[model samples]
Target: MARTSTKRLIAQARRALAEGNRSYALMLLREAHDGAPKDGAAAVLLARVLLVQDHPMAAIEMLAAHLARNPRSAEAARKLSDILASVTPVTFSRVDAAGLAAALRLDRVTADPLARAAGLLLAERGEAPAFTRGTDESALLIALLEAAPVREPGLELWLTARRRTALESLAGPAAEQDEALLAAMARQTWLNEGVWPVAEAERKAVDRLDPADPAHCRAAALYLPAERWCPGRDGGSDGMPKALAGLAGDIRRERHEMARADADLGPDISAADGTGDAVAAQYEANPYPRWGWVQPPLAGAVRAFLDRIAGGSGGPQPDGGWAGGPLRILIAGCGTGRQAVEAALAYAPNARLLAFDFSRASLRYAAMKARRHRLDAIRFRQADILDLPDFEPPFDRPVDLIECIGVLHHMADPFAGWRILLDRLRPGGLMYVGLYSASARRGLTALRERIAGERLAGAGIDPADTGAIREIRARLLARPEDDFERALAESADFYTLSEVRDLLFHAHERPLTLEAIGAFLEGEGLDFLHMDVRPHIAEPFAASVEGGHGESAVLDLKAWAAFERDNPDTFDGMYLFWVRKPG
Candidate 1:
């Protein structure tokens, strides 16, 4: 075959592969191989194609041929080694026995199969295996003895019995050995195979240690699952500590109830008023009131969005690259100030950051973290996002970024709040706004509201009391069938994907479609640079014919007819939009 033909065929195969036509690419590679039987390049391409198709053995054979021809090909050798390590079980052999022994002696090959095999091979070569001071040579040897099938029957039987006897002996007098080794062995067993029995045995041995022994508690804690310490209240089973056992069942029950109440539409029965509608009332009664933010995921999403925009070419230009000076940033509804502090530390190390939230308690917690880390750049303030008393732009040279994630959905008029934010953005500045998507969450909202009302009416206890809260949570959990209905009812409000579009872009009464969103950006002095649907909004649920769904089709449809008419772009569920003012 001509060299030019081989090159053309390889290029064609690469293009097909890039386009995800793997089968077609493989056919081309096979044809090329037929034409150029001894061509090393053809063999290499065939090997790569086979590897992608998961025929590792075929890849190995092809790569081996290629390597034979090109002995100096480190890339080919590395690829061959990786495939071999992944597929072929590492076995002890005389060829590399000394190297393995040295690694084992240094404790570098502990627990890994290839390393263990090498060590065993070295030991078998009549060389005294060098044992590291704190290394577990006995355990390594026992594992290798078990893995390698002995050709000599008598020798095999003796080795097998010795391995078992070694484990038994070490396990029998567990109190005499280091607690760390016992815990490590237990962890290894658990990782290799979910052998809870081994872990349980190890835990029992550690528990037998005297209370005064420092290692005793550490060993027990190491063996204990994290869930045992902080078990989620929702139906998860984890044994609690004796000191916390009394509260465990109650906490679990409370968690169950809270989950249900969170799902329902009614007021939380645990609140001072005994209504499950605290969230609804909090927003509905005072959309602009001081609100408390929780959950770092919510805050982090907003921060990421703003950072993306601010750093982009179309948005505000940084004064001196990212490190030239700190960019002034504000996190509205910055609960606990985690996102705010993170932003200060990440983007504008020298830049001033003001983290404002309505809850004094949350701010206090944020302050504690800031002080602990000795971060002097962040300033935590307790203030309402809706009615800012003295918020001026250009703290240094205009607020470069503003993050408002879940806050907009809670407001009575989110657009009003959005406009207020837009006015605050410095020219070429970026604002990250998240609101609920209507297309996805309307049905949920309706159901949640209905369930919350019923629960609140039935439960006569004060919402603020622990008992009342417990009762409310219990009621919600009792009817697991209506969990979604309850959640929608309790949450402040949800927007559909289309609703988010209309709220952010369209001022007209009629909602805009995908086409309209793009067109509107051109019409208004604003530019819709990018938009991202919230990740949680895409959660799959059972499909229904009632038009109500959890996933947003509006956002999913990337290209659609532009809105010819002035329509409202109303929807239910949360969405993030990055819009910019022309510089």
Candidate 2:
């Protein structure tokens, strides 16, 4: 029952399984399980062995037993859900389905988004989109949507922007007059895991709201947030339409109602004068990078990460910080707090998380979500990232990890902000950075230029004008100058009004090249840790790089530049990479 004994058992089990000795492996695994009865890793290993032996019923029973003990074990939950989902309809009995649903706890609003998606999908609940309507893969892909809310750390924000044209075909831009569709919109926003990006068919619906009739205000709750697509909604300096004014008031009230503290939704953070102020303002209005719950990584992926923060393998802590204490994590530019919440949930047992954004509205939404999920370790503040020197550090301790993704590129002088944060991170501490790629966005920028040239210089149809946007997308799709326009239509970012504007109308953005990234790394004196890339592409990249540039875990940006030249869409979530200051 000793910890060392359990480790030895696991090692023996893995070796036995590798040598085609299932019975020995099972015996060793059973010993490991008894040693740590609630260990999800033990359950996972045992299940893999059982499934290989065609004993799925035994596997399910084992996993369900572990899950009953460790309810929040993201690993046990995922294994159970995946097996339950994969069984043939005839073989999957009601008892099995109930077991899966119980693990998901579908009655709750914030279960693991993917698990919920898979459950609904396996249950044949939420209807499939037209593309997958008749295909056998329909269930699989629809189920993936549950897990796909935020594909990468920052993809939830920019993804929709790129897929605006394609998203129209998914679940948005419904008729305002259709009560059934409107109800679906409301359900999509609240009851569902993530926002569905609905579009109102009528632009004039905002003009028809009666200022005298309060009943008209009821529709304003869901309608106003979805109405962000409409143009001139924010241009109400004077003499705004009665219906528009009413809706605006309702939105303000709704945000206020959701506010957690007295000054929760106030402009404390946005009042700063910073390089990224303009970009911050845009997100203040419509927070980017939206996502919901996600199953944490598998236990085997990072054994220590399965529960608490552990000292990094990168060697001794450079700051010589205490080893046994919790990790220090900062979620810079934590919009609406999902990223921060994910961190809190993932590392709640052994980390202190501090999240701050320049948008109070975003923070308010994040606070509400954190409270709903009971993520208590995370602390939210209205401090600007630029004022890091001014904001009091929690515990007066240095940070071990900092995540600033899809934000720096928006700063007027992004590098300056980078320098400031770099100073705060302890030597050998890791930082996850996401920046726009120049090579990838080259064609995208050109397409945006042409789209702007056609529109009357910010006087185009309201973004709420889904019909008009669709017409524009259709026109571009029909007569695309090249593959870029077609790519936009097919992209996941082609969906919402906010997403469309983010892709095209971003006021301040500059793409970075891998060469530039290398230079930045050299200038910052940070070691490149890893670059997240598609394995399919990375496979050939590894081969090519080994032949020419040599192999390294840290990416070769010069080689990456060439790679992007050949595959421009490689950095859709931008170039997200990790780095650490020299230990």
Candidate 3:
């Protein structure tokens, strides 16, 4: 079990692999991994060998066991995560959740099993009640809630029923006193913007309670912090029970801090009347996609990432300041600062980034996140995309890269905004753009039309009304599982107030087809270097092309368009691709 022996075994395994002796490599790697169970490198090597030998299940089990021992092993975790993500409908047992949490993006994990379990429990018990302590469902739900927003509609409905039961119990002496359950509810409601509908009777019961009462504040925590039931109770938490008051205080502190951050956001490029103002107002009210956690980036040079993605497709090479000094990056509409922080950290000590958006609330959220990450180099400013054409940066020179993802399609003129962003990019520099595909989002488009036509016919629903949004959500959720509109329930956005608004009730949205995108690229005279498609789409499309996975096939716009026509949902997320400006 000596460290030297493990290293020697690993070195021998590598030599065997290089010599075309896979069996020897596998045997040596297994011995090395068994000797040093916590050694991530040895476990990763063993797993790779297992995979190459057509033993995928063995590879997964080995990685899982390695993660259980050394949960912080990035090498083992990455390999496990890649395998898990490549396959669909991954079922995690109750025992597996805690061990896999370190490797998997738990928020994105399928909640269908949890929903089915809860449903079976409800059917047996006659109703959904307060989660009893020490139950499997309770522990699993709490872990998922804490990790990320739970996106499953069935789980949301089950929780809503349970929340109502807990609220009703608050009116009696033997109230819902489970602190862990209360905390989990608070986190879920806060993340979802209190999208759960409250029955009028339950609302009236909560209305009759005193705001100063400890139980009232506890019940109110299950709703959004801004709701009427919890108003003016800040600092009033003093002299109350510690567990009850702490949750309330935490919510108030977050809102207060966000307000302070809003005041501190530098620069102002606020636009008056038109599509820009309406869109700005929508985001200002509820910052889209309230993010909690950010994944740390692996540090590397900016050009290294470009080369990996570009694969030397042969375009004009970037020149000027980027070649020798800090790579300048402009992240237009960097909502909540997740993208900005990732970019800034990924190219640390070698990149200067400016991230801006029109909504002060969003910019404020992003700035606070950047500060939390200790990223001082990012210039977080408030600016509308329309105003960026006239805006000047503190640093001179066009940026080496411009990233405008999921932003331009909402504008009155997406092309004009794209043109403005392109002008800011240095010649031969790269641009990454993500635009909505009209073909891919046909179902969502129909749903949006239905909501506008049926729900908001004459009076028009206010985007900020939680009650109205909840009603609409309930109606959608009531649909059959096979219903096309019911598919919205599967989206993470459906669980959150702000995201649902952005997705289904946006003031302005225009989805484009690939044909239009190809034409725009032609007119703009930019080289289409790469389309960031996942392997499932990329592999099939590349095989269909004449050159078959060559540089020409990857860059073939017409082929890509035809592929999209055949497989419409290829870009359901967006048409995220990279292009280079002519030198």
Candidate 4:
């Protein structure tokens, strides 16, 4: 049980794992963890072994127990949250109410992952389960109601329907406190951007209620915008009850941060060129994604992490005399800072990251989050992709990695912006690029064309118009199941205003074919390293193309193009791939 003995056991476990003796490694890790229950390394390794052994339920249980005992263990929380987020519905079938209750107790686990677990739990149980006020499930429900910006449709439907029921039976003086159920409903309605469809009866009920009442204020939150509901009746709700202070504080912080960003955007955010200005305007109005929580990444060196994701085929191995020193990463368009924050956490002290975005508003949001997380590894700047070269002096060392996901396609000339970003990469450095696939976006393109051709209300509405987007969403929902437009309702982006605008109403978007992208890479003398794809897509494509050349088959763009041609929706979101500059 001594520390030295536990370290030796962990060393043995690593050796066993390197030799592909997973069972032996698991046994050794269990011994290490049993001796040093508080050791994060042993706990994380043991849980991972359990996951690999196809006992995710066991893994979740072990991680939850570890976190419960050692609440300061961030590694255990990260692993537990990742499992909860990635666990399939079938996997959830094994998780009983007790298992979920244990998971709900994990501190530092974000609301998104917890909501996912709770939602999947409900999905397994079929009909909505009764939630007792003091139970873990009820706590999860309240937390989701308070902070989940991402939609879990099943949970949302259940909560909204329950709210409708609560409103239908409105009784007592409006000045009285709403029951816990109505309070939770009000929080959810606000978090979802106040766009949840409301019935006329409910609106009338809110109209009839007294503004001075807590119940009335809670009920009004369901149908009215935050500004209206909290209208600063007495110099910014000085008399606001403690129960509602959190919601008011959130609204106040967002407005203040935005106003502050406008004045302090810094000198780097010079006037953008051409369509860049328009794209900037769009994001400045509403940053593409307004994320609530971030899942901390697994601890590892960036190089080793990339190698694992690259599969058996080699990752971007250092070449051209480049040393494997601390990483210098440049995030070309870090909207809202979600990706950049994850990178900052993942790379930690070993990486220097610079994340830039077109919108000062997004930079402000991203910076606020980074500061909140206490991550000084990253620096957020407001800069255009086109203006990057002018800002970076030629004598400065180039970055080892450049991440440009879902950003280039919005430019007036994507390739021009891409070339500029490419030049900033050190020789032998890797670049991660995500672009819309022309073949896969046919349905969405068709939808856009229809909207423009028919001059739908969404076509002419301002990009900042949430009401119009809500109307469009309602119309899409009303369509029959077989309707092609109705299929868009399945996207999570449909639930949020900024996401909806970015998804459908972008000022400019250009999707490219894989063939064109491959040709461009070849022309630029770059090597296609790997395509970041799900195993479901990669496995079949590898099996069909080049007779399953292990992971190397993923590097063949021709095969990917052929696979995409057959499966038009394979890359519906985007073709996210890694490429290395030739030495």
Candidate 5:
């Protein structure tokens, strides 16, 4: 089909969906995919819808074939990889040994996407090729190992053997040739509690790596906070690229900040204002959502979801301001300004945005990022979400859209902060909230008790300190692999010391059941609007909600709760949803 024909088919598919005709929509999408098998967008859209309908393997096959034809589509390849990650158990058993072997051959850095995908799928099933001494592991393969434990239990033995094998190759001929790869592997293993002994030659190899090479810089950065090794120095420093130098400096500065006493954290951070002193102090030490955008490897896409919502194609604005003056958007608890900055750039020329965080250090870091990116579209302030009434004007002014994600749940009383945010929204204003899901976090809840009992997390220790958390996880990982390893490894937070600490350990947190959320919304007279998850996840949700009758019904908390009963991981991180005051 021609490009115009493809566009028309996609439009027709979308219409079919909007009209509650999923079968017809799928047919259209299938037609669209067949017409453009190599088009990343078409392949992903079709595969995604299939996944939502519970035909995961079918989705995988479609994407896999598409990738075979168009290996260059990172977008499509990533989609295939995600499906493989989720459906690996089924895929592992279904993939004949021959196909698995064929897939493994393509795991090289520059290999076709099919090969990389195969290696990752194998790793997810705990069958990454034996780690031979002096051999190279693709970056994707390493990520698969880190996340595999969650997908398949009892992977500690496999992961441990792989770690030891990689360690044995240290300072071997291959290490000398690709020392950066060794350093990167060591960093990953360290997070998993398998710190390879750093030989002197290995240290020298990493230290001498030139800074200008972005790839090497990333590998070296991973190795920088070595518990026993000095980064960029042995006897003296070899100059790095300007970008690397900045990052090296920031890491050191953060270490210093983490070590500072609470007294020096100032009145706002140290003193309990809205959230209790403990939570404030924890974030102040860490300065969350640790971004390295300014110096190097700027995020290719920032404020990803919000940007999509704001740039929503010719749709009704969330605030019902589709035909009116510019909208006002507020990012409550704007950690390090990631969402705030994204909102600014995304909605600019159409909406004004104000972002505030309780932690001054966090706000400062966010400001630096905005300035670095030359995004003046946002203004940052240090304020508590609970103190919304006291915020000075225009920052305090009622907003058409308020985004309070990953914040309220940490409060001593989530409802208190929630009520304040609701009051501050103009009538008919929209609010986006993210809070922990009780069902999804059952693992986290159990692990916390086990962790404390194991003497890994307890009194006299600050969970916010990356060094302390690393030691704790190291000890946890070193032990005979147990039940908790999966949750620990599955975290994106596991990629970095600070983030890992945040995920497994936090000063304050509360998870809510869907039923409770339903009650809360009812009590407050707010309307449950929508979610960002795949549509198939929401397909049956409508029929279960308070007033829902079919696909056209409003997405309600009751329906979400029902969905989560069987799909417990539906909101693994948190239930992110939009609500309105109902004009």
Candidate 6:
């Protein structure tokens, strides 16, 4: 076949595969392979189609034949190895072992044969007995060891004894030559022990062994006593003691905070202002607050914003027929309860509001705020957002109003969590949620992440320790000139506006958009009453119009959008929407 014909056949096969015509694709690929038996690309494609069609043994056979003709072909070698590694035992046991032996004989089997053997062993253990020999013997042995049932006393004891002897031998004189092997042995032993403290101690001891000696570094890092040995820094291991102490302190502080009552609010309003003596006293009394972000002004602003959102100015108005009864609002992820307290005071004057957060220290502070205001309508609970069993049953009626701002974006699965919240809403209930928007700030975040990675690598900062965090924070807060550069470089799991739209509206089947409030009311049998663009900033401007302008112009646009989107009740910073279900 001509080169042009082969290319055309390959293109057609790819198009068929993309269009979900797998059988047609396989036919085209087979023709292409038949025309050019020596063509590595055609062989690889045929192998891929065979695998997709649930014929792993066939795929392996095709790849092996291609590699036999072109021994130096890296692509063919790679494809063949991958197919072998992934083949099921049912398929692998049926494979011509003699052919595989020939391939191994051609060159040293440096690639991971253990993974391949494991897959094969999973389907047929009878063929595994023959695998424990030759230069590639260890791979087969390890695979059989892993595949052997743990509950089988005979096999378990045999593998355990074999593993122990192998590890002990590695600990001998020649262990230095294969540090990775020695480390792997140590990790396996530690995992078998099932004791964290013992494992940690062993890891520490290993780190103290010797860096010039790779075996020690690997063993220490992988198992108990895994601390880096610094010969001159101190008689002790390098930075491990300090790191351990910091972790212990964090755990202890959290426990202490959880045990304390929420009566920290003093009669003196000055002390409650979160400044000067108050801040010092609070820190001394409760240490958990020291670990996280804290800005008194920002907290106050968040509270004020929540109040505006709940005041019925930008939210749905209660029907006169329903009477202004006690409204039940729930605030999920109510960190510090600042916004929760603000909502209670601003909107639910005669209603009951429940606010919950994961951090005991934050809940305590929020409880203090509620007490300070003498507000009886608000209640605070410390609870995980994902596991909200406590709030589910007693509050069986869907929440009348729920506010979750700057919370969903942090969750590992934002869309899933958002769906859970939506399920908890009353038929005519209102909800407000916020997420980090991808824009100028996202660019800054990526830059910061890169800088952090570089600093961690350069300083040899332990990834598990607070040292990296401290180093990054110091560089970020260094000078005005350094701040912008550092901020821009950092990366985080933030979403762009388009990503948010697809996630909430498209993927999860939730009704979300810039026009979510109105659309949900109309489509979901609710009332689309009002929307607020931002709640945190004094000035409001669309994200597209916010940057790259004079301060005067920025402020002017912000002022205009404040009224333009939803007048008199608009606040800038976070986008807010409110809708109500009709009774």
Candidates in order, TM-scores: namely: 0.39, 0.64, 0.85, 0.83, 0.62, 0.36
Residue-level lDDT of model 3, residues 483-555, one tens digit each, is 8777777665777788878888887889998788889899999888888888788778877743275877778
Prediction RMSDs, each to the true structure = 18.0, 9.9, 4.6, 4.5, 8.8, 24.1
Using lDDT as the measure, name the better of candidate 1 and candidate 5.
Answer: 5
Estimate candidate 5's RMSD in Å.
8.8
Please, what are the lDDT tens digits per residue for candidate 5 over residues 1-583? 7888888998898888788888888899999989877677888788877976778877777665665566566666556555654464344444332323222223221122333344445555454442333323343344433222112223334543443444344434444323333343443443333222333454566676553444454345444453323253332334443433443454455444433422322345333354456677766766677543211111324233443434344333444343334778788889777777666665555667778777777776677666656776576766776554355556556677898888888888888889988888877667888899989888888876565555433554556544556566655555554545644654545544446556777777888887987888999988666766655555555544533666334455565566688678878878888777766
Model 6 lDDT per residue over 1-583, tens place? 8877888899999999999999999999899988887787888888889888988778876665565566555555556655554453444544444334334333323243423433243334443453344433334333222221121222333443443443344357663223323333343332222111122333344435554343443334333322232232234334333323332243344434533545432211222122223322332232221111111222234334434444444334444312344567888867666677667755644557888765455576567546555677776765545655445433566776788876665455555566667677765566766644433234434553465357455574432333343334334434474455433222111111111112111111112223333333355554433344432333444333533354453333333343334432232134454555554
What are the runs in model 5 whose C-alpha is more than 4 Å off? 1-89, 92-119, 122-177, 186-236, 239-271, 290-325, 341-349, 364-376, 388-396, 438-443, 453-468, 471-495, 513-523, 530-572
Whole-model lDDT, model 2: 0.58
Instruction: Indicate the residue-level lDDT of 102 in model 4.
Output: 43
> After superposing candidate 4, which stretches have Cα over 4 Å from the reference?
1-21, 24-44, 61-75, 91-107, 126-128, 131-136, 165-179, 199-213, 231-234, 253-264, 268-274, 305-323, 392-398, 453-463, 478-489, 547-552
Candidate 3 global lDDT: 0.71
Error of 6 at 358 (Å): 2.9
| Span of 10 residues, lowest total lDDT, candidate 5 | 293-302
Instruction: Put down candidate 4 lDDT per residue, 155-223, tens digits, no spaces.
Output: 656666766665555574334333555665666666666656555566677678654566556666666
Worst 10 residues of 4 by lDDT: 314-323
Best by TM-score: 3
**Model 1 poorest 10 in a row by lDDT:** 493-502
Cα lDDT of all candidates, in order? 0.45, 0.58, 0.71, 0.71, 0.58, 0.47
Candidate 2: list runs displaced more than 4 Å.
1-182, 189-201, 205-257, 261-267, 271-275, 299-325, 393-397, 456-483, 545-555
Q: Determine the C-alpha RMSD for candidate 3 after optimal superposition of all C-alphas.
A: 4.6
